[model samples]
Each structure stands twice: as C-alpha cells, then as structure tokens.
Target: MAQWIRGWGQRGWAAPAGVCLCLFLLLTACGQSAPTGEKCLNCHEGIEEISAAHPMESFACVTCHGGNPQATEAEAAHAGMRGGRNPSDLAVLDAACNCHNGLAETGQDHIHRVRTSLQTTYAGAIAQVAFAFGAQPDPTARYGMLAVTDDNITTATGQPALELFRPGPDDSPMLHRFADNCLFCHVGGEPLAQPYFYRSTGCAACHMVYDNDGLYKGGDPTIDPAEPGHAREHRFTTAIPFTQCNHCHNRGNYSLAQMEFLPRPDLPDDRPLTDLERRELEYYQPIAQFTLCEWKLDCIDCHTNGEVMGDGDIHSSKLEVQYNQCQTCHGTPDALPLLTTIDSVDHPAIRSANLNPNYEVRVGDTVIATTRGETFGWVLWDGQRLWLTKKVDGMVYEVPLALGTACQQKPDEQASQYCHECHAYQRTVAPLP
Candidate 1:
C-alpha cells in the first residue's frame, strides 16, 4: 500500500497530508482527502480569484499575502503561510494621501512665506538671476521710463522751423516724437550702445501679467492681499531694504556679479565688492559719470509725473517735481538759469569763415581739396575765408555765421593757407550758378 501511495505521489495524482498516514487512510476511505498546488487550481482558477480582491490585487498568494491551499494540518499551514502568525489576521497599511499629496496643514506657514519656494510643480523652469532679464532683485516691483522729443520754439522769433519730427507727415496736436520703457535705451538703431550690464529687451516675455480684479474699490487690501504672486501695488522705491533686496541681489544664485560675468560697457571698472565696500555703499547708489553719476533717482521717478504722484501719495514724480533738484545746488546763487548761450556776432573780413561756399562765392569757383579718411563734397570757401562745419548726409553748414573761419583743418594745416590765396570773395554774391 505504501509503494502504491509513493507511485501516486510521483505521478500527477494529488498528495494526501503525510503527517499521519493512519488519518490519511481513514479520510481517504471516507472519501475525504487533500489536494496539491496543481490539483486545486485545476478547478478553482486561483490567479483570477486573487486578482478580484483589491487589497491583494497587486500580488500572488505566494508572493506576500501568504496562504497554503496544499496543506492539511492547520498549525503547519498557518506557520508556512504567515511566518508563524495566524493566516486569518488582517494587515495594517499606510495612508496613500500622506505619501503622495500637497504639503501638510502644519507646514503651510513655512510654505507661504517663501513665495518663490511655494511655486507649483508646473510654474515653468526654475528662474535664475541672469535668466530673468530686467527682473528686479527685490520682490515683484516696478517703475516706468520715458524718452521725449519736443518742438523747442524760440519765443523771440515765431519761426515755424522748430519741429521735432520734421520733414514727415504731421499727424498729432504737437510736433514731437517719443518712446518709453527699457526698450528705448536697450534696443538697437540709436547711437547709444546697448547695455549688457543691465536687463535684456525680453523682460515682457516672462514678466507679462494681468489682474483679473479690474480696479478694486473700497475693498480691504489686507483681506484680499494682492491675490498671491500678482503685482497689484503701483508704487516702488529705489531705496534698498536689508534682507529684502539681498534675497535676490546678494552673492549666491542671484548675485549681480554672476549675472554680469561677460563684458559690459555699462558696468563700473571695479570687481566684486568687498565686505567693507558693500557696507559703505548707499541704498539707491548713484551711477558714475558715464552712467549719470549725480542722478540718484531712477527712470520711473522722473517719468510717471501726473498719474501716480500726489494722487495716492505714490512717489512717482519725485524727480520731475523738483526740476531744481540738480540746478538748485549747481546753479548761480542769484537763481539765474543754469545754462547760458552766446548770440551770433557779425564780422565781414573774416577769412576761413563761410567755408561751405554757400555764403560767399565767385563765377569761376575752382576749389582744391585734400583727401581725408572718408572726405566727400566741396569744402566751403568764402574766397577770402575757409569755412568749416560738421558734415551730415554729405552736406556741411556753418553753425555760427561769423566763426566758421577759425576751425582747425586737422589733416590739412595748409588748407587754411591755400584757401587764403586761391579763393577770396565778398559774402554778398555767393550763389549756385
């Protein structure tokens, strides 16, 4: 009988619980027996059963959620399945929300204080100091800037020639041309060089924002609180704050020196400031000579005059209001105008004057000229005088009528002597023949 049972176990037949052969024999006789791993799954489909249960859906019974379908002894089966624990015991699991969600309620204070740190996962790439061109080091703040051209008329003569944008279509009430904002100086085409030391022209790309609350009236600002991460306040100051400005301005990721590693014509000739130097520095430090040394005020302080100044106590027009700000100290003690001009004088025998040949000329106007680097057109000769004025668009004009004769002819010193002999005439007859 034992040999027959061994043959049965060796074949595909199910194995009885071998601990007590007598009990197995009696159970088999009573038509009750145990099934092995393969025999039970043949009818039950254990894989499908295990998958239907959500708690154990992630693993098979043998993987972790342990059980012994093949065993008959209760104690041995429980020990094998649960490492000596009862097989029917329920396991405690960790909370899903705790591991994968937003910050906890207790951590809210720390999160809100650092607005930059509170940036959501989707706030675009992290911003570096150099990355944000024209971005202020302080928390979101701003100022406006302007450039204007006006028709500076002479009250003495009602001359209509005082036009800012002349030789063009006259469209507006005033004769003037103007542009404002950082682009005026930062952009190309103007004679002024672009500032590499300062912010780039692409400031609007990242900084552009809109306020959904269109003009809030009588609302408590503290209760509404500028709608987190938005710029609602209109006023800003150049006065640097202690930790406020240093958060983004001092050494580290947002250091000014790091942003200005490249060659910049606008930067001062000094390297990184020492601790002593930084301590000595003023809050709204004045720029040096090439960068307007005396002007402690910034661009917006002078430009945003009527809108923000005196209206809401906004200090926008501090510079414009005090036009005497600069002149008050620099001008004459008697309050005379800071600037003075010299009027035109008349001199007839002036030789080297009226050199453009426009004022004084003769019938046979043969003028000998020497070649300079890129010299062009005829030099003005009054027959008796050799005239000189800066050339613009291939034409040169004498700035003052009398003193055109004395300007030094650099490359040609002999130009003065040569004109005295060959070309000489009276101022009354110069004309285009």
Candidate 2:
C-alpha cells in the first residue's frame, strides 16, 4: 500500500495533524462503493480550507458538514443545499471570552463590582417603607408644582398644568424603581462624556477601586491584587458590563445620560425645589445621592487625601474634608493659606506635630504683646494637633507642639473634618506681621 502524508503548514485543512490517519480509517472502514458522506476520505479531501481555518473545530465533519450520509454523489447529499444541523445560538460566533461557561467576568477599564442586593419581593417592601414614613404630600400639592415642561407635553394654553402629583412616600412607580436599587446612577448622572466615555455618574466616579493608590500603593514589586497573595481583593458597590464606556456616551441621541438627582449635604441645590421636581431629580443624583451635573467635579476631585485613624492608624478615612470650594467666598483658617489655583495646585503637606512640654500662653482681661512684638490671645489648643494664637501684628500663627506634650482627641461632630475644624472663621486679626 502506498503511503500518503501532508505537512502541518498546508492551508485549507482546519484539522489536526492526524488528518491522514482519519482518512485511512475512513477508506478502510467504507469500501470504494461507500456513499460520499460515509466515505469521509473521498468528499472531505479538498475541503481542506475549512479545516485549515478552524483546525480545532473543523475536525468534527459530521457535526456540520455531513447530511444524507448514505448518498454517494456530492451533489445529492454533501451539497450543503440540503439542510444539516446549524450552529446553536450558544455556539454561534460570539467572542470566546464572552461565552466562557456562564462566568461573569469583567475586563480591565470596566467596573464590575456588585453594589446593592435588592429583595426579589420589591413591591411589598417599597409600599411598606412609604406607608411607614406617613410623610406623603397631597396629590393636589404635587400636581400644583408640576410645570408644562415636566410632562414633556405642550398645552394649547401655554403649558397647561397637569394633575399628576399625589401624597404618599415614594408611592410613584418611578420612586419605587429607584428605592429598589441604584440603577439610575450609571444610566444617567455622570454618563460617559466626549473624548473619554467613562461615566461621571457611575461607580467609577467615586468608588474606583482599580487604580494604583485605590487598590495598590507605593512601589512594592511583589504586589499583584489580581492574584491571590498580593492584597485584599477590592470590593465595590457595582460594576458595569461590556467594559466599553463609548457604547453609551458616544451613541448619538443618547441624551438620557443620567438622572438629575435631588440635593444632599455636599450638594445643597436640590432644596427649595418643588416636591414634583425632587422626585424627578433623584434619578439624576450623583454618587453620594447628591447633584454635581453642571459642576464637572467628582468625589475624588475634592477627597484626594486619605487618613489612617481608629487604633494603629489602620482604618481608612478622609485625611481632609475641606470644602475649599466654598472658601473662595468664605475664609480658610489663617494658618492655612487658600489654594489660588484650583486645578494645578499640589495638596498641602501636613505632618503630625509633637506637642510636648505642655506649654501655655495666656491673655488676661487685657491682651499683652511679646518681646518680639507678637500679640497674644486665648492660647487656642487644637487638641494636641497644633497651638494657635493671634499675633499683635494681627496675623494668626501656628506653633509646633513638643513631643508627648499633647494627646489626640476625637474631633467634635461639627469639627470632625480637617476643613471644618479650621475654616469656620470666628475672629479677625488686628493686622498682619
């Protein structure tokens, strides 16, 4: 018997290198008079292109390439004009990784953390929450607040008002959808904008736990959060699928970028809004359930510093929470100068000053001036953080404390934040030094 062999590099046969063995077996098992489909050796010979293209998948001939197996003529059976089992939707041309056995995996540059777990029994829970509050407004009050624009319907009489609003906590279908979970955040709020499609309203806006400092810190070569040993896996509130920001942002007619939300602590604009507008606004609120739509700044823009508090400096907290944005109009602590440039300024460096030797400077009924011509006052102690006083020259001054001279104390509720503790101006200095 003459031997037949083909090299691996041959183009058109999407099959394994052992194709010849399959052909030999086919020829031996089916005699020369066997049907073309049955004699896979005869009909599958030249169709090497299919096999070559899908070397792995092309090997299973009967699965797709076989029909009317006993028919001898290629035209009679193998002509694919006759039907065969077509590819299933599950097996059809989807990206390999997308169909990876039902596992929900996200690619780099995408947020995939699950943020909330809503109960399947949503309707009942929502009704209960609304009824418990018993703070529902009257239906007339709600409709009275509606503007022609709210309904998107134009009236013959210059935007006729509609009777839409009703009393009851989150009784509307819209509010119910919102309370069930936070779907509105990514859908609108800070949707991906031009150039970069990263949503300004999505989890990426605030809880972006994928960055260097976010999930990793300082250069430590052995670090690899993706792997098991590197660090704790970063958990987030929610994750977006498809990993493409452009899909939502760049699409034309994508005006429904995010829901405009009601005002909250950080954002104080939503108040004074009519009850009707407040309901519509919740869908567009920022991550903190606040509004930052036109402002163009996210949570990270202001909260760039991190603090270590809670026994051993291990727990994470904001190092500073100054709303310096307000200080442009208000005043900052005299010790801390205002950052003139909002964008390019480097954050001021702060070090824990040692407060030892427990010293005190007193100002009696009448203030006194020091030999250096510095004026003295109540000798404000910043709770072991710093010693502050006003100089006669009319300038506020800060003095470093001696080591072990002071102890750290928890800031009061109102002064818990570095910015709050320092910026609320109570006194004006006489003159600058």
Q: Model 1 — TM-score against the truth?
A: 0.16
RMSD of each: 40.1, 27.3
Alpha-carbon runs more than 4 Å astray in model 2: 1-114, 117-183, 186-421, 424-433
Q: Which candidate is the best by lDDT?
A: 2
lDDT of 1 by residue, 350-398 (tens): 1112222222222233232212111111223444432222211122222
lDDT of 2 by residue, 289-346 (tens): 2222111222222221221000111110111112223222112333221212112111
Count clashes in each candidate, considering only residues at least 3 apart in sequence or on different chains.
14, 39
Residue 243, model 2, lDDT: 18
Q: What TM-score, to 2 decimals, does candidate 2 have?
A: 0.19
lDDT of each: 0.23, 0.25
Lowest lDDT sum, 10 consecutive residues, model 1, at 114-123
